[model samples]
Target: MADMSVAAPRSRGLSLPRVNIRAVVMVLYLGFLLLPIYWLINMSLKTNSEILGTFSLWPQNLTFDNYRTILTDPAWYMGYVNSLIYVVMNTVISLTVALPAAYAFSRYRFMGDKHLFFWLLTNRMAPPAVFALPFFQLYSSIGLFDTHIAVALAHCLFNVPLAVWILEGFMRGVPKEIDETAYIDGYSFGRFFVKIFMPLIASGIGVAAFFNFMFSWVELLLSRTLTSVNAKPIAATMTRTVSASGLDWGVLAAAGVLTIVPGALVIWFVRNYIAKGFALGRV
Candidate 1:
C-alpha cells in the first residue's frame, strides 16, 4: 500500500513539471504576441507632446483627440468607405470564381489538372511589384483604372488562387461517397453542390473569406497604384502624410490604429467558425 501511494505521487510529480513548463511557455508567447498591440494602444492615448517629449510606459495625459480627428474628418471616413467597398468586392469576386474552380479540382480528373493547380498557386508566389506596372497599364487602357473595380479585380489575381487552394483542401476532405450518394439519389451537380457540399464546407468558406478580407485590407501597393486622389484607399492616404517637413507621426499612428477596426470586427464575427473549419479540413 505504501509503495502504491509513493508511485502515484511520483507519477503526479513528473506531470507537474511538464504542466508548469507549458504554462510558462504559453505566458511568454502571449506576451510576445500582445506586447506590440499594447504599445500601439498605449501610444494612441498619448499626446503628440507626450509622445515626442518622453518615453513612458503609460501615457502622461491620456487624450481621445486622435480618435476624434479620425472620426470627424471626411477624408479619413471616405478612405474607410473606399477600403470597405473594394475589400468586399475583392472577396466576393475571389470566392465566387474560386468555389467552382476548387470544386472542379477536388471532384474532377482532367488532363494536366495537377499541373494547373500548381500553376494557379504560382500566381500568388509572384511579387506584387512584378505585376504593378502591367496591372496599372492594363487597367488604364480598358478605362477600368482608378475605379474600385480595378483594385478589386487586381486583388483577385492573388486572392482567387489562395481561395481555390484553401477550399480545395476542405472539399477533398469530404468523402467521395457523399457525392456518389447524392448523384444516385437524383441530385444534379448544381443541387448537390448547393444543398449538400456548401453546407458541409460553410466553415471553410468563412475561413477563406477571412483570409481574403485580411490580405486585401492591408494591401498597399496594388491599391495605391490602382487609384488616385478620387478613389485612393486609406493605405494611400497614409503615405501622403510624408511631406517636405516630415512624417505626421501622430496622425499616421492614429490612422494605423483605426485601420485595425474593420479587420477586428470581421474576425470577431467569424472567430466561431475557425475551429470548425480547421477540424473539418484538418488544415
Candidate 2:
C-alpha cells in the first residue's frame, strides 16, 4: 500500500457555509405577510360575482372595469385628492412643530423637561377614539367640519408628539458645538436651522414625515369624524361602496388598492433615509 495512508479527502473548506436559516425564515415570513395583499389585488381585477361565487388563488375573469369606474368618476377620484391634501398638510405641520420642540428637548435643560417629554409621549399613547367626539364637536362648532385642514389639525395632536419623540433622538446625536459654531459664524438661528441643521438630520426628517403621512392617510375614525363631503378621505369614500344591494366588492377592492398607492410612493421615496435613521437608532 503505497504509504498505507491515503491522503485524507481534501477539506471542503468548512462545508461551504450553510444556508442562512435567518434569511430563509425572513423570506418565508414576508411571503406569508404578502399573501393577503396578493389576494386583494387578485380580487380587484375580478367581477363582484366572480369574487363572491368562487374561491380561487387567482382571478379567473380579470377585468379593469373596477379601476375604470374609480378613475372616471369624480366622487371616486376626488377622495384620493382629499386624502392627499390632508395627509400632506398634516405631515408638514407635524414636522414643523416637532422640529423646534425636539431641539428644545434634546439640547436644553429646562424645568420639568423630563415630565414634559413624558407628557408628550403620553398623547401618542392615547387612542384616537378617545378624542373623536371632542374633535367632532369642536370642529363642527368652529365651522371647520368637513374641511381638509380640520383633519390635518386633528391628526397633529398625535403626529406631533411622535414626531417630536423621533426627532429628539436624532437631534441628541448632533453635537451642540455645531450650534455654537454656527452662532459664532454669525449665522442667524433660522438660517442655520434651515440650511445646516436640517440637512444634517435629513434622515430623521424623512422618517418623521413618512410616519406622519402614513398615519394621517390610513386613519379612519378621525378622518371620517372630521369630514363628510368636501374632505372625505378615500377610506370614508370606500364605505359608500356598500349599499342595499350588498357590497360592490370589486370597486371597493379597487379603491382599497388605490388608497395604498400614495403611501407606497412615499415609502419608496424615503426608504433609504428610513433605513439610515433606523440603523442609527434615531427613528
Native-referenced Cα lDDT, model 1: 0.85
lDDT of 2 by residue, 84-155 (tens): 999999999999899999999989999999999999889888899999999999999999999999999999
Q: Once model 2 is optimally superposed onto the true structure by TM-score, how far is the C-alpha of residue 267 displaced, in angstroms?
A: 1.3
**Weakest ten-residue segment in model 1 by summed lDDT:** 1-10
Question: TM-scores of all models?
Answer: 0.89, 0.89
Each candidate structure's count of clashing pairs: 0, 0
lDDT of 2 at 278: 46
Instruction: Give every collision pair in model 1.
Output: none
Which candidate leads the pack in TM-score?
2
Candidate 2 error regions (>4 Å): 1-20, 243-245, 275-283
Candidate 1 local lDDT, residue 180: 95
